[model samples]
Each structure stands twice: as C-alpha cells, then as structure tokens.
Target: MCRWLAYTGTPVLLDTVLYKPVHSLIDQSLHSRMGVETTNGDGFGVGWYAPDNGTPAIVREIGPAWSNRNLREIADHVRSPLFFAHIRATTGTPVQQTNCHPFRHGRWMWMHNGGITDFHRIRRELALAVDPELFLDIEGSTDSEMMFYLALTFGLEQDPPGAVARMVGMVERTGHEHGVEFPLQMTVAVTNGQQTWAFRYSSEGASRSLYYSTEVEALRALHPDMAFLREVSDETRLIVSEPLGDLPGAWNEVPESSYGVVGRKGEDDLLPFTPQPV
Candidate 1:
C-alpha cells in the first residue's frame, strides 16, 4: 500500500537516495514495480535524525510526494545518517497529514507499507489495548499509527522485537475476532535514532516487497567499475521497498517474516520474527 526506504551509514544529503537513485522513493511513488499500487500518492512523510539532537525531525503533509515542492527543496539540503522516507497510498484511511506514514514519537520513528485488513471493524478494540499514555499520542486514524502505539503499549522501549511481535499478534487476533480471514499485513520500519529495525511479514504469509542493499564493500569488490560503489563509504547501507537501481548485485530480497537491523559495518543483524501473544 506504500513504498519506503531507510538509510543508515555515513551522513549525506537526503537527495542521495530521495532523488539520485534511479528508482528512488519518488520514482516508486509513480512507477512502483513491486508495490501493490504503482502510485502511492495519498500522503507522505520524512523523518531524519540530525547530528546535534537526539530527536528526529519529521515533516509530514497531505500531498503527493512526487509533486510536493517542499519535499523537493528539503531533500536537496537535509543530511542525516539515519532517515526514513515514505510514500503513502491509502487502503481504508482518509488522506490527511496525521495519517501519513513515518509516524514519530519521542525519539522513535516508525512507518509501515501495508494494512490491517478490515481495520474499521477492529479499530476501537485494538486501540483500547494501547497504554493510555501512548494512546493519547495517537493523532491519526490509520492502522499504521495504531500499530506503533500498540508496540509502545507492549513495551517497545524495553524490548522492540517482543513488543512488535506482540503487537502483530494482537492485530491478528483482533482481525480474526472481527471476521477477517487474513488480519495483518505489514512491512514496517522503526528506529530510535541510534538503531534501525525493519520487518517484512503478513498474516497470510505473502508480504509486501522489501529489500536491503548488500554490503557496500562486497558490492565494490563485485563491481569495481561502478563509480557510485567506489564513492560511498563501506558502511553505507539502504533498506528499501524496491531496488534503488537496476544494478544486478546492489540489493537482496528480505525474507518474509524476518527483520533486519542496520548499524555499523560489523553491527548489521538479521533475525526471524513470529507472532506471539502479548
């Protein structure tokens, strides 16, 4: 239902991917090859963790990313080591600024690329499960934002994996209770400024498309002639909803029902995720 990418590595202007990539998020907004929809223009948002501050700055609006002049101007200048960019295509939610993805809370930033089936049927029940503190932070009416709060309610700050897993489990249960056969569908990304975690999964086992770049050093060794590879740092890595370019060895498909974390060169990690009761 949407397209997104997360970047973690050496700092660079946001345009490095927001515009420079051959099939960047902007391109995906209008010509997605693997997303459910070719155009994800309902709304858009971007969150970046600047160097001096611990908190990320988020700019969200209710316009299409492809033609938003403000997005273009900002991308040309903003630089960050960790950032999330998303293009939205509404499944069942109204198109509004608050409903945009790349939702932010405190120092954490989150965004999702899919939906919880029949969200309206279980919205209240699922919302009631969130911790009152976080529930009060809810500003939109999308399953995506609700999922974020549920993760917080389940203790995301203490244990992100368990909190997210429990959040998914709750969505599945809530959906089933509301008579949806396949309740949860989400490919989500969440970050705490210092670390980033991205997941690909769905209740039906067929998840939205997601990919992560191969190691820059490995890619450099594999295709030494490519100028872009020679220029970027060895630690630079990108996880996206589609390939950034047509480069053969530039990306690897993220396995369904799994998650990946991007940190320093030696700190990148991958792990399996499964639904578990809260």
Candidate 2:
C-alpha cells in the first residue's frame, strides 16, 4: 500500500537512503516491488531529529517526491542519527498534509505503510476509544494517524510496543463487533528521535514488508572498498519497506509478526507481538 523506512544509528545525510539507494524511497514512490501497488506517489514526508533541537523536524507535502526540488535540496544537506521517510498511496482517505506520516507528539514520531480493513465500519468506535483529554490532538482522518493517537492514549511514551499491541487489540475487537475479519494491517515505524521501534503485522497473517540494516561493522567487513560505508559509524542502521538496492547483504527481513527497535542499551530491542482479545 505504501513504502516507508526508519533509521536510527549514526548521523548521516537524509539522502543516504532517500535518494542514494538504487531503488531509493523516491524511486519506490514510482516503482515499488513488494508493496500492494508499485506507484505510491500520492504524497511523501520526511522527519528527522535536528542538531539544535531533538524535538523532531518534519517536511511534508501532498506531491510526488521525485518532483519536489525542496526535498532534493534538503536531502543533500540535512543529516541526523534518526529519521523517517514515507511514500504514500491513499486508501480511500482524504489527501492532506496532516494525514502525512511520521506524525509527531512531543517526543514521538510515527509513520505507516498499510491500511486497516473495514476502517470506516470501525472508525467511530476506534475514535471513541481514545481518551477525551488526548483526542483533541488528532489532526487527520486516516486510520494511520488515529492509530498513532490511540497508542499515545495508551502510554506510548512510556512503552511503544505495549501501546501498539493494545491499540491493535482494540481495533480487532471493534472490527469483530462490526463483523469484519482481519481488521488490522500495518508495517509501522515509531520513534522518540533517540530511539526507534518498528512493527510488522496484519490480522490476515500476511503483513506488508519491512527490513532493517545490518550493523555497520558487519557491512564494512563484507564490502570493504565501499568508501561511503567507511564514513558511517559502526552503529549506523536502516530499516526500510524494501531493500534500497540490490546490494548483496545490505538488508535483512524483519521476522513475521515481530517488531524491532534501534538504539543503544535496551533502547534497541525486538520482541514477539501477539495481542490477545480484551
């Protein structure tokens, strides 16, 4: 349905993955091999942690990314240790800036590359599930954004994976009540700038694609002559919806029904995610 990537590791220019990869995110917008559709040109967005303020900076527009000169220019100049890039294809939802992915809530930033089944049937109940105090912050009509807010309402800042599991459980329950099967689907990326977490799951048991980078040291040993690879710190990593290129050993598929986080210490972790009905 869409293509997205999340990176958390060494600080590097945004283009390293956005434009430099052979089948970059920009290219994926026009030619995706694993997504439901090859063309995801509905819109694009990029968010990164700035050097001055780790508050998270975002640039989004409802236009094809390849045609955006501003994005091209910024990609060459801006760099960050953590960032998110998304290429969207609408799923029966309005096209608008607020609907753009890599959404922010104080410290957290999020984006998604899939849709919820029978969304309209369950939208009202899902929305009503949000805490009243937090519901006012919602700014888009897409289930993706609502999913983000739902996670926040369920303690996302304190626990991203837990919040997401809770949100999915809620969606599944609502969908079942509405007689819709396999109601949740997503390849999601969420970050607090300092740390990042990604999830791949679908109620139908076949989720969208997601992948993460190998450690820089491992890559360096495998492809020693690559100059650009040498420039990056040993900790550098990238998670994408598709391999940026056909480079041998450049990416690894995320396990089925699982999620991973990127960072030092316990900040970067991955665990099995299975939501029991509530």
Candidate 3:
C-alpha cells in the first residue's frame, strides 16, 4: 500500500537514508518491488526532529517523491538523529497533501504502510471513538492518520505498543460489526524524538513486508571496510518496508504479529504483540 522508513541513531543528512541507498525510498516511489503498487505517486512526506525543536518538522506534498525538486533539495540539507520518510499510494482517499504519511503531533511522528480493510464502511464509527480534544488535530482523511489519532486517544504518549494494540482492537471490533472478515493490515512506525517503535501485524495473519537493519556492530564485522558503516554509531538502526539495498546480511525481517523498539541506549527489543480490548 505504501513504503516508509524510520531511522534512529547517528546524526546524518536525510539523504543518507532517503536517497543514497541502492534501492532508496525515492527509488521505491518509482519502482517498488515489495509494495502492492509499483509506483507510490499519490503523495509523499518527511518528518524529522531537530536538536533544538520540541516538535518534529514535517514536509508533505501531493506528488511523487522521485521527481520532487523540493524534496531533493531538502534531503541534501537537513540532518537529524531520527526521522521518518514515506511514499504514499492511496488506497481510496483523495490524493491530497493532508493525506500524505509521516503524520505529526507535538514531539511525536508516525507513518504506516497498510490500511484497515474496508475503512469507509467503518470510518464514521472509528472517528467517533477518538477523543474529542484529540480529534480536532487530525488533518488528513487517510486511515493511517486516523490510526495515529486513535492511538493518541488510547494513550500513545504513555504506552506506544499498548495504545497501538488498543487502536487495532477497536478497528477489528468495528470491522467485525460491519461484517468484514479481515479488519486490519499494518506495519507502523512511531517516534517521540528519543525512541522509535515499529509494529508488523494484521487480522488475517498475513501482513505486509517489514525489515530492520542488522546491528551496526554485526554489520561492521561483516563488512569492515564499508565507510558508511564506520561513519555511523554502533547504536544506529533503521526499520523499513523493505531492505533498502542488497547489502549482504544487512536486513532482518521483523517477526509476524510482533513489535520492536529502538531505544537511546541500544537496548532495542522485539516482543510479541497482541491486540487488547479497549
């Protein structure tokens, strides 16, 4: 449905992750091998946390990323320790800037690569469930942004995985009430400048592709002469919809129905994820 990537650890130009890889996000926007659509041209967005800003900065547009001059210009200039980039292929929503990915609220940023099955059938129900105060902040009509707000309503700031599970639970419950057998499909990423969390899950068991980069130390040992590996820190990590490149031993699949966290101290974790009733 979409392609996205979350990067944490080491401050580097956005280009390092967004444009430089052999099979970079920009390239994916044009010739994606792992997404439902070969070209994700409906829209694109990038959100990054600067050292001095509390809230993340976001740039979104309703255009293909591969040909966006502004995106290319910014990627060459902006640098951050953590950031998210996404290319969208609308499931059914209109192609507008607000419908782009990497949605933001306060210091947090989020993006997704899947959708709620038959969202229009359950859209009104799900929107009604969001907290009134938080619902006002929603600027997009995509299920991805709706999921973000739903997670926020369920306590994303305090407990990310729990909030997301609750959000998914609500979606599944609502979908079932509407007679939809498969309710959700998502590989989501969320961050609050300091830490990043990623999830891969769906109601039917089969989910979209998701991968995380191999540990920097391990990659270093595998290819000692790679200068880029030497430039970044041992704690550096990246989670993407697909492997950014064909580097040997460079990516690992995130387990089905599970979530992972990349923390400040390199205390990353992978654990089982289960939807809980709200």
Each candidate's number of clashing pairs is 0, 0, 0
The models' CA-based lDDT, in order, is 0.90, 0.86, 0.94
Mind giving the per-residue lDDT tens digits that candidate 3 earns over 89-207? 99999999999989999999999999998899899999999999999999879999999999999999999999999999999999999999999999999999888999999999999
Candidate 3 weakest lDDT stretch, 10 residues: 261-270
Model 1, span 1-278: residue lDDT tens: 99999998888899888988888889888999998888988989999998889899999988899999999999999988889999999997899999997888899999998898888889999989999877888999999999999999998888888899999999998788778999988899998988888999999999999999999888988888988777778888899998989988888999999998877453788899998885
Q: Candidate 1: TM-score?
A: 0.97
Per-residue alpha-carbon lDDT of model 2 for 163-232, expressed as tens digits?
9999989888888888988888999999887778899998998989898877778888899998989887
Q: Rank the candidates by lDDT, best first.
A: 3, 1, 2
Question: lDDT (0-100) at residue 86 of candidate 3?
Answer: 95
Estimate the TM-score of every prediction. Answer: 0.97, 0.96, 0.99
